[model samples]
Target: MTKPLDLKHVALSDLHISLLNMRHKPKTTKGRSNEPILDDILPSIRERGIRQPLLVRPEPTKDNKNAYGIIAGRRRYFCLQAIVSEGGEVGGVPVCIMNADDDAQAIEASIIENMARLAPTPMEQHTAFDKLSKKGKTIAEIASVFGITTRMVKQRLALGQLIPVLKQAYTDSEIDNETIFALTMATKKQQKDWFDLFSTDEYTPTGEQLKAWLSGGGCITVEKALFPMEDYKGTILTDLFGEHDQFADIEKFWSAQNAAISVQADEYKKDGWRDVFVGDIGRHFPRYDYAQRTKEQGGNVYVQIGDNGDVHFHEGFMPKEEAKRIDAILHKKPDADSNASNRPEMSGPLLEYMSLHRHSIARAHLLKHPKIALRLTVAHMLTSSGNWKVERDYQRTSKESTDLSLTNSRAEQELATERQAICELLEYRCEHFQLYQRYSSPFNIEDVFGRLINMDDNSVMRIMTFCMCETLKNESGAVEAVAVLTGAKFEEYWVPDDGFFDLLRDKSVLNLMVKDIAGKSTAEYALTDTAKSQKQIILNRIAGQGVENPSPNWRPKWASFPSQSYRGKGSVF
Candidate 1:
């Protein structure tokens, strides 16, 4: 059945070349081994006249009168045709005739010779495979003939199905294989949209970022969804790989689920909870801080609803005094005895001892820095000068008096201008006052003074130490202590404003103010309420409203509330 080749009779012979008889060759540019022109082989063929002989087999009756299908060395045939077209000297191509019985054998021989020279590009290979498949070859049959895995063939076929633009991009090296794999998971519309973004936008996401964008960001997997699937009100969709299911309408699912949690929170209130505070959807109450209260203390319950329809029921958390009351009741202890135990034992003596030791160390440290102490002494001496009295008088006078009190007006304007210049030198912006304090650790005093003069660290530290020496009213006898240290009235310079009220959002600080300034009963009431309500009440008390005989001149000495203190291993002094 099979015809054998006469290898010994293969001889050099002349034959005309034509494109029509190369029917087995693919028409696509991707299928051709040397498309366009073989710039490298053309000149050499022009000089040496065709060195390698073209492998050919007798064509079927349907082919041209030439009656030969090229199996190998198509370059030799093309080169001779090129020389003829350019009106240069040309001759027939040498031939190695194969006695093949069918087109498959000739095509296989061509593929083997081409592969032995240099493997085709992936696109080219896929195109060839696709052409074979079109000619009624099975995937296994094609893989067997080509010496490639069936899986590889299938993968190439899938790549062959990619949109034309993506194929071009792959060939151009614009996108890698991983990105192409991700694009395969996308729908045609999604692929077009991504291509538009990639081509036109300045920021193009690739790899994982592109994958996340393609899969809706809010999409939740079944494992991550805390609520039971039976309770989920909306539909769910699965991924392309059948790996996971995601919520179809995350917002709708959360709405239904959070409503259920609200009912649960209300039921908790009916079950004798002191109060129930449910967090808004997408908010989680920090458990470490809010879980400090116990059940018997009449502590409130906090219910939180998460994005994935998860519900968290945190119960029995309340203020300090309420917790103490429950602790006393549970232990069957007397209230007075419990209150006495709650009070710090010998706190005043312990405080005094610590203060004495701390002050002694500080003084010894300051002694090492005499330049700093001298600056503080100078600031103290200047505090008693007539300039301060004149400055205060100028600041207090009405603007209406400025036309008449020319001397005082001139003094105040000069002083204000100088102070603003100093603040600017420190890179301070009043609008960003909060950020100034937040990033205070990165601020250097030497950097501030260096802008104005060639000041050393010693001079900068001296000026800073002098400015920092102020008597803040934090203790019971703080008023007397301030009067002795600064010789200034507490109510003379400060007043309430938006900034001051904003800082009172911290519940601990607001409650302490209510206890000390608005009496014990107001502090107790404010402690049990939300921080927002406590802040409002504190603001009202500051403005001398609702409370009996409120002190309008009760401004604290510090410009802002002190940040939470942290003492590190190194000495700050």
Candidate 2:
């Protein structure tokens, strides 16, 4: 037997969309279909004075007390929101509050209620199933909940693997089911290339043609082989539609080709070449970037492998810089005035010893005068003189979603705003300036100096601080030191999103996060659960869903200023 949900009336202002809602999409996801139409529902609700009650749970975080997160009836909530926006007088809307602790139950109720009202789109279904899957629900269990076949559930899950653009394209009805399904087989690079072609007026393959394109234009024919055909140990694939025979195994073909390349490299080495460098497959060797050089002048052999299995060797070539250096040495115009040898009196070790001691004395003296040190630091950033070649940190990440997450983060946005303000203050025309752009236009030194001279001391300090922040190296000891000194709070600037959760794979770390948010007892109970289950528990607690007391503004240890590992084994700081 189950207890009934408590029925109540909640004000529209107190309700918000929940993270658990199946229809809830992150703002980061662009080109998504518009929200459900409220026109039809608004008219009916306005006339009849409301009908069905919205299903909601207690707001997940303590920051919003007395508020509720709508798990079901999102469209109705939106309709009510619209009505209020239009300055319509509305009373407390009817609501049914579910147990906030039971995330799985809340999710199930949301899905069931949505299904009862209207069929969700395939992408929406995928989003729901993906959440369920992350909550430790098996494929069979999810299928059972939705009353669909396991195969259908799996098909929905596969949609999660598609890139955001492809997903958006499918949602926009620009591409059909067959085209999308075929694209699933394509690699990220291939999908990106295909999408680039599709976005233009170029001929983009579709459906069966896409499948053929993914198969490297219907297999690697023997005539396309860079190595001897007899050297390949794999069976040859014969195409009935074409006259030429193809290689059955792409891997095997590459192996023979690579072996042949190695042999050629060795031959070059034996033929008095300085060095033989083999670039990775798909890498292009730019001949125009290099200068032809004789073997005696430290020329090297460069082997480039094309994507289509073609190989080309660039012989007797060196970098333009190296060529110039060699030319300078060979075409020397000696100074006839004196015969003094171009040699230093001090040995290398002696010079290094003296330099280190001198540097130590200067550093010790500089450490005593904090104000002087600050001025020197500012000077280094402003002029970029001596060894101070200040450059912005790249903040590189392999995952596209993670990269996007950082780009769209509140912290990044705040920095951009600050940069724009600074640019305006400096009297620069930077209407379209991006703070992190690789090749931003250079500021005129005279114009900048003239402006800075007129600014107040505090204003100059702010500019200096921003410049230091921009050039600060990421993942360095300086970052940890500064974080500790400043008491930097990451939670104020960052929140967990799909990108953060997707990158988490360690079970131990996930369990630790569970303990941090849900408590030791809950963590112990879920110790043997799947990584996905632990992750959901963490998210639920963060949202203030199922816990008695939720940690507001909760952040993982790794996201902390001086990041720490769960086991204290791999402290990145």
Candidate 3:
């Protein structure tokens, strides 16, 4: 009933062409032009005489008895048909016969041949790829078969998901890559919401703007919220990889969180803090004008409440006017301490009482001329001069020549590193400027002067955070507050090596810190030895060497000296 299929049965004869099989593929027709492409193809084909063979498959009896479907080379089939119709001198057209069982197999062969040789239209590729995917081909396998990347395959599949109208625009090259990526996240309803604007307007958002617009006000993660979990009256949506979960109802969460924060601030105010400032939404903490004041000044404390229930307490800072009033009180000479000449009474608070008067007078003058004070402070910090200089002063015992070049190299390296770190943090870019330039250069002048004048409230606050972190002496509370608020942890980045430990001259402080991290037994043991031996033992513990039982799960915690530690009970300001 059926003839055996054989590859060697190829021949050179044209039977009646099956119109029934060919009708389904009007898109894969001969050419784009209205006129027949046969006009241009005929002369060359006449000389060449169909060097390549047509691929045809045997069709059943019902459509046209003894007919064959043209799987490929439709142009050649048409050319030979034209010659036959015109009664021209043409011999039999060569063809490779295929015994394809059905129309789907025939259609697949035609698609594969075309896709292999020519670039298909977006819709054509979409149709083909969708079929392959639906037939259970993995993205990698499809990419391998089509000689494309997995990313390209994914993009094409994403493009295929677009609605018919948008897909048609993409086919006509109306939309760009960024718009496609942005639109990929938009649902049909979301697209319809902006359909009028998309269809009519000449202007359309493409990159980050489009993404932001599609994403709404964005998301708040669990770590950044200030309110307790019990107070959150909203749901959360998880990321695809389950790495993070974001608040689904962002507005609801913020409303509850802000109310809680306001109550907390009020509680702080009622507890007798001079002043309190709450951070605004999507904004940084505010900086006090007179942030550098003495302990007696009763500095204003700042509390920042994050959306995810993170509370950062910044202590020991105050506004300028409040600092001035407190400075006045501290400078008021204490009625001569009636028993000042008495030996035992003179030993303790009375000595501090008299010393405070002299320091306060100097501080009053410095506060009056803040500009000069800031310049002098900058000088001290930069050159390690005055009280800021910490390098041990030893007599020059030998005639080792002072290599000024080496000194300059070290200074340049430190300055360059600081400059790069600041620029990276601020995302500030300036052309034709060296970050390590000397003060004589115009760039350096602009950096120091222009930055002071040009800083906005937000920029000023950010700079204040950096300055407070670096220059606020003996105020570890403020440093920890800034670190908590900004997510900048010193221990996370810095290594605790011998050079760092060498600066800790206070043996008591060193022993306390060692106990905090390495436990009481390790500290007690270190305290029994000399300070130098204690320092070595602590360094060994940090490096995880030479210690028999190292502290398990040890992480460095920088000390923050509480204000109460420096104040005596019942002491008057």
List lDDT for all candidates, in order: 0.56, 0.75, 0.54
- Candidate 1's residue-wise lDDT over 17-36, tens digit each? 22222223443544545443
Using lDDT, give the best candidate's number. 2
Candidate 3 per-residue lDDT over residues 108-196, each given as its tens digit: 55655544323355455656666667767788977766555676666667666567666656655677655665565566765656455
Instruction: For each candidate in turn, give its C-alpha RMSD to the true structure in angstroms.
Output: 30.3, 20.0, 25.3
Which parts of model 1 have CA positions greater than 4 angstroms off? 5-53, 57-64, 82-91, 96-107, 172-174, 218-573
Error of 1 at 386 (Å): 66
In model 1, what is the error at residue 290, expressed in angstroms? 22
- Deviation in angstroms for 562 in model 3? 64
Top TM-score prediction, candidate number: 2
TM-scores vs. true structure, each candidate:
0.34, 0.40, 0.36
lDDT of 1 at 129: 66
94, model 1: CA deviation in Å?
Answer: 3.8
Minimum summed lDDT over a 10-residue window in model 3 is located at 559-568
Better of 1 and 2 by TM-score: 2
Q: Candidate 2: which stretches are off by over 4 Å?
A: 1-388, 434-441, 544-552, 569-571
Per-residue C-alpha lDDT of model 2 across residues 1-573, encoded as one tens digit per residue: 787999999888888889999877657435544466665457767777668899999974566588999899888888877777888888998999989888777888887766544456678888888888888999999988765668778777878777889999998789987688667656688889999999999899997577667665544567767677889997674332233556656788888988888988999999999999999988988755676565777889888877667777877788878888878898998866578777886999999999999999999998897655555565456545467566678788888878888889988898888888876766543324433334432333344555676676677788788887787898789988888799988878888887888889999888888888778977886676667767767765664443456566888888787677888777666
Off by over 4 Å in 3: 1-51, 54-56, 59-94, 97-99, 102-112, 136-140, 149-151, 217-573
